[model samples]
Target: MTLGTSTSPLHYYDVSSVDGFNLQVSMVPVGGGVGCGVTGCETDLNICSPSTFE
Candidate 1:
């Protein structure tokens, strides 16, 4: 689903169940946006993000 708004397009991610016990999530920018550290902008998550931006 679209993580952010259509106008902003901050992030896009997919979600699914893993082993019927846990959740699996993967995210990337809608177009071409900066990641975790980008001067005035930054990204945060309760768990973790991939090593690479993807």
Candidate 2:
């Protein structure tokens, strides 16, 4: 995602799990201003640790 314009209102975003991931993900940018920031993968990944999915 990419957005900028409206006199330079900018926000570029990316969140991926390389085609696989189970649950827990986030991005919050409400009332954006002054470096609108928040992005995440609050890990649960189906109880990860099976060799970290190789």
Candidate 3:
């Protein structure tokens, strides 16, 4: 059997986003000689303050 053809760009995977119960990792260039690994972005933020009461 033969597979179908892909009309999208070679780097199409890096230019797309996913949504749902599944998890995926994506990389995108930021600037000169630099790139970033972005995933589970919700956990990468400071949504709460440090412990104050013990």
Among the numbered candidates, top lDDT falls to 2
lDDT for 43 (candidate 1): 30
Instruction: Judge candidate 3 against the unseen true structure and give its global Cα lDDT, from 0 to 1.
Output: 0.33
Candidate 1 — which residues are off by over 4 angstroms? 6-10, 18-30, 36-54
lDDT (tens digit, per residue) of candidate 1 on 1-54: 555676895654444333321233344434564464222113343236455432
Q: In model 2, where is the ten-residue run with the lowest total lDDT?
A: 45-54
Best by TM-score: 2
Better of 1 and 3 by TM-score: 1
Candidate 2 per-residue lDDT, tens place, 1-54, comes to 788789876668888877757666789988888877888888877676586585
Query: Pairs clashing in candidate 2?
Result: none
Better of 1 and 2 by TM-score: 2
Q: lDDT of each structure?
A: 0.41, 0.78, 0.33
Candidate 3 local Cα displacement, residue 52, angstroms? 40
Ranking by lDDT: 2, 1, 3
lDDT of 3 by residue, 1-54 (tens): 122358632331222223321233444444423333343333322234244311
- Give the per-residue Cα lDDT of candidate 2 at 47: 71
Q: Show how many residue pairs clash in every candidate, following the order shown.
A: 0, 0, 0
**Poorly placed runs, candidate 3 (over 4 Å):** 1-22, 33-54
